[model samples]
Target: MLRRVLVELRRPQTPAGLAARLGVEREVLEAMLASLERRGYAGLAYPESPTCGVSCRACSLKNLCPAAASEAPQSPPVWRLTALGEQFVESAAEGG
Candidate 1:
């Protein structure tokens, strides 16, 4: 789950945003995000839009997600990949 979240976060996403995309519960998603944050794999980014309550609301990648529309509006804050996250994904993809 964390690996999947890392890949999605490479673009941008919130705990709720990812949950929506993955068809998972917000609580489950937030736990994954928190784990990523603790491991220095992700970080939060505030939304630029005044109407966007959650930072992930404005993410361009949301449209491509299967579960994007299912998530509730009040999902937790957005999370983005940290440098470590990027590296981890790349290495994992390379069979590291």
Candidate 2:
């Protein structure tokens, strides 16, 4: 069965969001995310974003963005599904 952690990552979100959604502690979520990253199911939207960038709220790649494209701010990392993750989730959904 697909893990709930992996399923929750179908959408990109901050670490805090993931924790809140799963109702788990941050440490547990971090471990899960690390494992997924090692297995290649998920990763940061972008390795990094422009320093003090603007909000990418409307763009599809916004999650990866470290900051909005405008000016004066930054955001936390956004975890997202990789190609393999998408395939995994899709196949899982289809199977069950």
Candidate 3:
């Protein structure tokens, strides 16, 4: 789950984006995201509505996320990697 979140964190993604990337249900993705948040592995950032391309707007299910709507739209979605998360990823990559 952490691995998946890290990949998603590399980009600004909605629940749908996670679902699609992870090949799981949106609810499952949401639960995993929540778990990551509880473990202090990730965060959410909502950016201003983009004026570029219709496809970009359709890329995420932002409308379904309450946290996304409550935050300032001007702020972009930022997934901060905690030190622990980074360490874990590095260790896993090194097969430690």
Which rank order by TM-score, best down to worst? 2, 1, 3
Per-residue lDDT tens digits of candidate 1, residues 21-86? 988999888887878778888766544422222434565555643324544333445567766787
lDDT of each: 0.66, 0.66, 0.55
For model 1 the local lDDT of residue 37 reads: 77
- Candidate 2 on 38-76: residue-level lDDT in tens? 888877664333211223564465644443243332256
Across 1-96, the per-residue lDDT of candidate 3 in tens digits comes to 658676555445666766777888877877777787788665555434322112324535445443344445443233434445556667777998
- Candidate 3 achieves a global lDDT of 0.55
Best by lDDT: 1
lDDT: worst 10-residue window of model 3: 47-56
Higher-ranked by TM-score: 1 or 2: 2
In candidate 2 the C-alpha lDDT for residue 6 amounts to: 73
- Each model's TM-score, in the order given? 0.66, 0.69, 0.54
Task: Point out where model 1 deviates above 4 Å.
Answer: 47-76
Clashing pairs in 3: 45-77, 47-73, 48-73
Give the range of the ten consecutive residues with the poorest summed lDDT in model 2.
46-55
